[model samples]
Target: MKNLLYLVLFLLAFSACNRKASDASYSWASDLHQRLLTDFCLTEAQVKDYIRRYLPDVTDEQMRQWEESGALECMMLDGEKRYFRNAGPNLFRIDSLCREVKLAKEGEQVSTSDRANAENLPEILAATDGRGDSCLAAPKRMRVTYTLTVDTNAVPAGEVVRCWLPYPRTDIPRQQDVKLIATSEPSYTLTSEGTTHSTLYMEKRAVSGEPTVFSETFEYTSYGEWHDIRPSDVLPYDTTTELYRRYTSERDRHIVFSPRLRQLADNLTEGEDNPYLKACRIFRWVNDHFPWASAREYSTIDNIPEYVLDNRHGDCGQVTLLFVTLCRIAGIPAHFQSGFMMQPRAWNLHDWAEVYFEGIGWVPVDQSFGLAPYAEKAGKPYFYLGGIDSWRMVVNQDYGMPLVPEKKYPRSETVDFQRGEVEWTGGNLYFTEWGYHMDIEYLNY
Candidate 1:
């Protein structure tokens, strides 16, 4: 009887251990959710509010689906009530949430905004190109010209004339390679980095015939400052010694903005607690360290140190994420924010980072605004960090998935940019593909 009892007891113990392991597998989700709720006291009804404020229209179902799809690996909510995620993980997570909640507001559908004025179009009288008759016989060199007329009364108050050279059209609509190579005026600035950047992004709508086409031949020259920073120069995670407990802790692979970020505090000597200085250094490091590239799409990569070491490049979202991560690791509190960079006649989506100084609360930082170096070289305008450009317009306040009480739908694994903005009345003018064309025109008399 004693031997039999021992065997039964051992079996029960084994079963309990197995169940614990299974729970651990999915515990990441519950851990994240519980932590956020406990700290923020976020209620079920407040889920939509948090989602709308931070993440836009992302639904609870869409976020789950995205998580299941392996898009977002993890998510973290900060002390300031803001949620964050890595690139791939966050994308899928949002998609899942959208699917789960039937009424989950994914984002405010901006379809009823003002329509793009059809009358405010550039008049193209004719476009002509000089090239050999046949493809083979075509001259190695090509010159193209366009004649345009401007609407006197339709001009935007602060608008300046920019150029859009033609690019070869292709079947792939999502391709970003299509751009204007030539313009009526020298509206673009060439950087030493070999990237031809233009502050003026043009949106074109055909008023008459199909847009003209052109090709490339030789290189154009522009005297501009260029930089070739390597992975080591920008990624300095291994260089710091202030914080290691957060990273080395054996509790769980996932962590919030505690020891990991708080570690950065050690690096500062005594008065380094000044939030303003910390923010400045963090901004400089991000802008200087991470090269601008849309390398990682919408998935999550929150571990800034790991991300900078593994991938030398990241876009605005990742860069801002890294900035926030480092700030948290260093003990400073930070959050994520996003919006559109609004120009005179157009709007482009933009994202930036925010940090809480002891007295200031939350301040904004955007490294993707060409950083300080990129700005100095261009010689056209302002520096990033501390000062944000007037062009920036905030739309979403959250980072990761929306807060959902129950799993309504699967979350999206990838982040998506809604092409057009509309209001309640339907101001949808989003083209499946965007194009630009500009010609030198005299002001209408």
Candidate 2:
């Protein structure tokens, strides 16, 4: 049984680490464990009661048998035994294993229906019908609402607070018809073109016991694009150009190229001369080999490409970095783009890559979404390679760029800027201290 397997592994780890299974470890762990769970809208008492119902089988005496089992790794922090976040839904699962753990008291699964996907079928059919380059609505019209709110009373009263919200740039071809609906409170200024990340900058005087909020409602066109890419039509960009050199070169820790990554890129594109063909090969290789897994905090990893190469798994951002780095090494002009993936049910923070070719300038590719599992079903296997679907909110043009009106304290998240950021004369407000919300509505026009 899977439970028995975890028990054995935990026993081995316990013995190797020489851990203590005393009540002191689990007791403090119980308190801090539920303390963090409150963020999920569950109270300490409710969590304890849930444990009683869900894990009636686990007992203090039995846990002592393999007390060092990894359910909750207990250690002495400041002379008190505490447990770290473990691999279970609630704190009880490590000691008492359960394949399914429900968050609320009710066992029902809450779900949402997806909005209908707008298609370019008419265009695709038109292109094939007339023998023209395959096309779709290059970009369709969309209206979006993005907001960032810092918790009330988070900073001292009257201190100058600064914040930046990701703003879509009309400069990108796939994005156009940019308009600002409104900005909350004291006015905002868009980040200058010179800044790497495209964001709206705003500041306000902290009001005593009042939440600081910033919001923008805007409309733009997003396209479901597909280029009928032909090897012969695809010409390489001149290597001498600064744009080509800049994109092909590495930037920051996430996009670095080490010997292993360089060699991996070499292997992935072996026997491939066509840039388009080479990109597809590397894209397929990374997708199939790396799979997908929940990632640890991004800040913890030193180099994303090296990490994926070594670990064989990563989330969207992590995998995108790997795919981007490998593509650049293969002599393709690949770069980063991240914002929100606006699904009908719910939008989420997401990242993807874009590469430039001669005939076609910039094309979007989502490595995590990968080649469609059954491309024939949609008549598109190289779909993501040359184009992307219509549902996307592109905010940050590049990652790891400095913020306009930089912060005095360390940024809570240093990697990608999806959720807005906040700071005051006192200090920076981490995600924990603030919250963000995004909503999108389509305009018929």
Candidate 3:
């Protein structure tokens, strides 16, 4: 009976001391301290000493107050046996701790020294991690189903999958709208079992180049949206503009505004006087002048005028970026557009650009398709803008994404291969020639 009483007294004393620690005056430290104690069974002295040992610059008084009730979150890890605290908005206490321990931490710090250290820590860690020479661990593969229904039973196998529908990674938004034509079936198979489809993954080894062709057509309202006018209608033309300066400084006088192109402009005056036509003419020039070469990177271009100067090669994406850059310099509004190019051999993703002209509004101009022969074949004086090949499916209408979902892998660039996060390289495969297959059904095709 006496031993039980003594035990109760000990617990009472500990509770009193802790209650004082959690007082409102020191709530910032106390709350977090108590949480840590509950999580990791840490003593107040141990917590204080840990904080002090790591963050010695933090005054003992500040540390004491923080221990009692300052702002910090003590989270229990290791099946609730270990406590962990993280740096929150008020990170001064933690920063002091980090400094004493010589540990680097993140967050905007008032002290520039911490900020400087934080910047280089990632590179150091990445180097250390890379040295371990571990290959990227592949995620668990799960089987998913997609059911595709066509509106008509008798469609050409060649026509079922449009040119631009993303196959392997089908998680891109509005993919079904473009890729899946009107189908007569009620239910479709899909890998993701959610209201909205998740990004899909395909292994390079699984696809054996066997064409999974479906033949059918269906009726549905087109989900395509027109480009905005007004501000979206005008291109940047300020001589002081960076784009204008980049072009003018690099381009030779003869090619800057070529007399031949100017004459070609004169020949087509009926609708050619329009800015849209002028932009098309420029796109034609860029397409014809440069050969399609995948050697250059999509991210950076060394010389804007060099392609025209040397009559050299560039890729679809490069020319698209160049055309947009030149159009912006010429004061014609332009923007980049990208999506899958519907082709049989499983082409990599494609990119094109749009120019907003006053009368014709926004028109699609993809020069990489080689417009001259196509125009001649079609018996048209000029190639069509705003008109796209039925072989393509546009997954996105805008560039430099602002509406991507959370936890996106690969974080999209100006152009993407599949609609979702993917990293595949047989070590040397370029963007233009890769293949994939898909099988999905739709309702009311």
The best candidate in terms of lDDT: 2
What CA RMSD would you report for each candidate?
A: 26.4, 14.9, 26.0
Q: Which ten residues in a row have the lowest lDDT in candidate 1?
A: 121-130
Q: Each prediction's TM-score against the native?
A: 0.34, 0.73, 0.37
CA displacement after TM-score superposition, residue 116 of candidate 1 (Å)? 20
Error of 1 at 11 (Å): 47
Tens digits of per-residue lDDT for model 1, 98-210 = 32442354543222111221111101001111112110110111121322333332223333322222222222111112234454333333212111111222322223333
Mind sharing the TM-score for model 2?
Answer: 0.73
Tens digits of per-residue lDDT, candidate 2, 170-276, equal 67666667888877854778876546677888888878989887888888776566676788877967999998999999898888888888998999899988888
lDDT of 2 at 46: 43
* Full-model lDDT, candidate 2: 0.68
Quick one: ranking by TM-score, best first? 2, 3, 1
TM-score of 3: 0.37
